[model samples]
Target: MQSQWGIMHGTHTTPVGRVRDGALDLLKWLALLSMVLDHLRYVGLSLDGLYVPGRLAFPWFCLAIAANLHRTRNAVVTGHWRYLGWLLLFSVISEVPYRMFIDDADTLNVLPTLALGLLVARGWQQKALIDRGLALIALILGAVFSSQLMFGFFGVLLPLAMLLVFRRPWYFSVLPGWVCVAANQWQILLNSGSVVALTGLVACLIAPLAGLMLLQYAKNVSPPAMRRWAYALYPLHFLLLLLLRKALA
Candidate 1:
């Protein structure tokens, strides 16, 4: 049945032998690093140059979502729900810290956008009616609240775009690569005319493909597993950074 869906949907959902892929762990760790680096700019440091690497964070995170969904396409229904529940839970738990650390935050923390992206990607990968309906609702909400979404509607679409090109050739990843740029607000970056902003624009453009290469060729490279508890890191990092900012002040 799963194979049938794979064929009909033109997805590479073949179940693998391993319980976890190390490449994915590596990707997660790198994404975490990129995120931390990005947030460091807010940590009372004059590290505006970090913005270029920070541009890599969101797309890499989205690629992680797509990679996980692609690999676990055959997992039990409850597992999928559990995955989403964790994101939703952390979205709420992380918001206060996110707002605290990010000065004048206009949007919610990045988790809510990731949660919606997950639903949209799952809708594309799963044949279940519930999945499709949830994706539709996610899309509507993303559209209605795009201004409130961290990366806006393009960010919501990024996971699905990554999933679409997950198993395809590396060139195919350019689709999501462009989406990553848009999600990062390439226009504003371009118009800024700063060297750092332009560098960030280029980083966003290639972040997805860079991540895909890591996933494809780095399977043997082991890293720590990024489990459900890792969700806490999202909020905890903000608190730690906020404290650092206070100390620096």
Candidate 2:
């Protein structure tokens, strides 16, 4: 059977079967909300504690990418280019607000890391020369921008790792979990007093498997509306947070 996007579903199961899992959508929004809360700590409050909740964002996003990959299995390889294009566009658009909101933040921002992650995942999925080239570019950019973000080069690699172990047994995800933890410098930090940090570290380790399992079991979700205003949400939310912070300050 085929869904509205003309992609096959309920047939030819991959590691995870084809389905429109609502839980994945729920996870994405939850992750997005958690990320916003984490950013709010920098903008309005010193709730460094909120960082734990924020940890959900990246992994959930990675899972979303995996879900998209499963859904678009039939699309031409070029279909992924459009997805990367949207991510790149958002990354550029969100740069100013991201920098403005987070003190001492590098301008490249999270979207670039995600874009690179997509390239790596697609390259691994399709094994194309262009995809491999794009992944290389992402890696180079991550290296160049490493000083700005704590996660740096490892962040770019996290999604690919997630894709690699996707849908395997829970224990199998540990390899990527270790990589995710290392990517975020989990062991190096000594935030012993901060439950947020500890929780975030643990979540980072488990998010891939959790996300994969969720997508594997659930179904009946709709894609987000693609109105132009929808894309503005990324930057606009930051502006709103900035304004809220200023008012409270």
Candidate 3:
């Protein structure tokens, strides 16, 4: 009999030894769709329900980061600078559009949180002086100015936590999810948050676990590839949404 954990090994095989995980790709597409729906709420849609699904977007993205790190562990030896560089560049590129698209977005866009999280994840893996130093500095900056960060320090730490528990059981996500809840303003939301807010909050907590389940369970589903072009979609979506908002307004 085949093992139950067969999905972890992936479905599609390549001669080059790299297996393309259709489930992972599907999760990415779902994440993208959720993000778009969340952003649409701001584009003059009275779709408050979108917020619930939107909550899944960030955590799923973080899980993707952790998954990518696990898949490309080899990059640790060969400098992950290119990965950092791309994120950093897009962080800069996305800022203006993010500010323009979102109302009063005083915080820096989400990419910085992700970039720092990547560094933190890497540090967790190797704990090298350089990796730890960079992660430390980024963490300090995010902590000192948490308000100016999209997800704040704890949000930046989430991906690293996810990375640490990448291969662990799905329930392990709850451990790091507390940090996620706190980073997402749990104190304020917990008391007065409505049904939607509370549901979204719960979704935020479980998104990683859910995403991991999708990766390890959903088999034989091929979603489109989300490659370098997908990075451009971040800023492009902001622009497109801003245009739509202008039209709707």
Q: Indicate which candidate wins on lDDT.
A: 1
What TM-score fits each model?
0.92, 0.82, 0.89
Q: What is the lDDT, from 0 to 100, of the residue 60 in candidate 1?
A: 89
| Model 1 vs. true fold: TM | 0.92
lDDT of 3 by residue, 38-114 (tens): 99998987999898898888777887887776766654355367778889999999999998899877789899998
Error of 3 at 139 (Å): 1.9
Q: Order candidates by lDDT, high to low.
A: 1, 3, 2
**Tens digit of per-residue lDDT, candidate 1, span 135-215:** 999999999999999999999999999998855656777799888888887888889999999999889888887887777
The pairs that clash in candidate 3 are none
Runs in model 1 with CA error above 4 Å?
A: 1-18
lDDT value for candidate 1?
Answer: 0.86
Model 2's TM-score against the true structure: 0.82
Model 2, backbone clash pairs (residues 3+ apart or across chains), number: 0
Which residue pairs clash in candidate 1? none
Give each prediction's root-mean-square deviation over alpha carbons.
4.3, 5.3, 3.3
Model 2: per-residue lDDT, tens digit, 1-249?
A: 111111223355453333445666676776678778878887656688787767767777776776677666655556677778888899889899887887677446777778877777776777668867877777777788765644677877777777666544556667767777777767655456466778888888887666665665554566562333555777888889989988999
